[model samples]
Target: MSEFDVVGIGLNATDTLIIVPHFPSYAGKGPFTHEILSPGGQVASAMVTCAKLGLRTKYIGTVGDDERGRIQIESLQGSGINLDHVQQRKGCQNQSAYIIIDQSTGERTVFWQRPDCLRLDPSEIDESMIKSSRLLHIDGHDTPAMEKAARIAREHGIPVTVDVDTIYKGFERVLPYVDYLIASSEFPIQWTHQSDPLKALELIQEEYGIHCAAMTLGAHGTLARVAGKFHYSPAFVVNCVDTTGAGDVFHGGFCYGVLAGWEIQQVLDFSNAMAALNCTAIGARGGIADKEKALALMARADRRVMDEIQRRL
Candidate 1:
C-alpha cells in the first residue's frame, strides 16, 4: 500500500510581490505601494493545498542554500508535507519570482529565473519515492526528471496528474505516462494546432490515450474531456486580488476530487471554486479555502459564464 496520498515532483519558489497602484505603461514609471515575500511554486503550492485538504503529501525537489530557499522549505515543513527528498544545493540560487501586482485590477506580471545548477536529474528519482505515493503530481519544468517520475508512477499503477503551462522542448515524451492532464487553456490549441478547444482536447486525449484531458480558463473556469464527452465548469465570481497560483491550486483541488471519487462535473466545479477563492488574496497559495468554503462556492456560486461552456458541449 502507498504511504502517501500524493507526491509532487516539480518546481518551488519564493516570490517577492510588489504591489503598485496600477500597471504602468511601457517605459513609464509608477509608485509601488507594498512589498511582500511569499512562498510558492507550481507544484509546491499545489502540494500545500493538498496537505491543507487533509492529504498525506510529499514534495521532492531541489532548493538553493539561500534565505529564499530556507523560506520555501520552512513553509513546506510547516504545511506538514514530507520533505525527505528535498535537496538543498549549495552555492546555487533557489528559484525565485518577482511579481508585480496592480492593486487597481488585482492582476500581476511576473519575472522569474531558475538556475540550471538546481536541476533534478532523472537518475535521482528512486523506486521508493514513486512506490510510496498513491498519486503523483508534476510540472513540465524539469522535463527529464518529471518523465522519469511519471514512468515510475505508471509502473506502480498510480495515477499521474500534470500541471503544465508553457510548451517544454520535449514534453511529448511525458504525455504517454500522464493519466490526468490539466493544463493552461493555450496549451492544447498550441500543441494540437486545433483552433477549437474541444477538438484540441479530443485529439490530444485520443493521441496520448490519457484517461482525461482538461484545461483551466482563467475567468472562464475549466474545460475537460472524459469518457468520450466534453465537460465545462465556469469560474466562480469572487473579489479579485492576484491571479498567481490559481491554476496550481485548481490542480490540487482536482487531485483531492479524484481521490474522493468525485464525478467529472463535481470535480471541475470544486476545482474552479478552489481556484476562484485563491484569487481573493495575493501570492499563489494565499487564500486557499477550506472544504466548507469551497463547497459553499460550488453550491451557490453563479454559473452565467459557464453557460458558454455548456453550449460547447
Candidate 2:
C-alpha cells in the first residue's frame, strides 16, 4: 500500500482578510468591518481538506522563517497532515495576500506576493516522496518543481491532479503528465487564448491528451471535458460569508472523489458542494465541512448555473 493517500507539492500562504460593508469605488473610502489573519494556499489548503476527509496526506513545500510563516506552519501542524518534507528558508517571508472582501456579496479582491527566496527548487523534490503516494496534487507556481514532481508521478503510474489559476511559462511540460487539469475559469482562456471556455477546454484536452480537463466557474459552478464529452455541474446555493478558499477546497474535494472512484458527474457535484460550503465561513478553511455535511448539501442544495454555459452545453 502507498504510505500516503495524497501528497501535495506546491504553494502555501498567509492571508489578511479585510472585510468592508461594501467594496468602495476606486479611490473611495469606507469603514472596515473586520480584519482576520488566515492560513491558506493552493496545494496546502487542498491537502488540509483531504486530511479532513480522513485521507493520510503529506505536504511538501517551502516556508519562510518569518512570523507569517510560523503561523502557516502552525496551522498545517494542527491539520493532521504530515509535514516531514517542509522546508524553512532563512530570512524569507512567507507568501502572503491582503484580501479585500465585500460583505455585500461575499466577493473578494486579492493582492498577493511571493518572493523569489521562497521558490522551490526542482532538486528539493525527492523521487521517493512522489513514489510513495497514491495520488499527487500540485499548483502552477515554481514551474520547474511541479514539472519534476509530475514527471516522477507519471513514471510511477500515479495519477496527477493540478490546481492552476494562472499561466506559467513552461506549463506545457507539466500538462502531458497531468491526469486531471482543474483550473480557474480564466486559465483556460489565458493558456489557449480561446475566448470561449468550451473551445478552450477542448483545445487543451485534445493537445495534451489529458484524461479530464475542467475549470471552476466561481459562482456559476464547474465545467469539464472528459473522454471527449462535456459535463457541467451547477454551483450549490448557500449563505456565503466569504469566498476566500472556495477554489482550493473544491480541488481538495475533487481529489477525494477521484481517489474514491466515483463517476465524473458525482465528482463535480461533490466538489461544487464542498466549494459552496466553504463559502459559508470567514476564512479559507473556516467552513471545511465533513464528508457527511458535503453529502447533505449535495442532496438538497439549490443550484445556480450560467445560462450561457448551459446553452453551449
Best-matching candidate per TM-score: 2
- Top lDDT: which candidate number? 2
Q: How high is the lDDT of residue 165 in model 1? A: 91
lDDT of 2 by residue, 1-313 (tens): 9999999999999999999999999999999989999999989999999999999999999999999999999999999899999999999999999999999999999999999999999988979989999999999999999999999999999999999999898999999999999999999999999998999999999999999999999999999999999999999999998999999999999999999999999999999999999999998898998899999999998999899989988
lDDT of 2: 0.95
What ranges in model 1 sit over 4 Å off? 304-308
lDDT of 1 at 205: 98
- In the predicted model 2, the residue pairs found to clash are none
Clashes of each: 0, 0
Worst 10 residues of 2 by lDDT: 120-129
Count clashing pairs, candidate 1: 0
RMSD of each: 1.1, 0.7
For model 1, residues 1-313, the per-residue Cα lDDT tens digits are 6799999999999999999999999999989989999999999999999999999999999999999999999999999999999999999999999999998888889999999999999999998998988899999988999999999999999999999997998899999999999989899999999988889999999999999999988888888999998888878988889998888899899999999999988999999999889999988999998888999988887763855567757
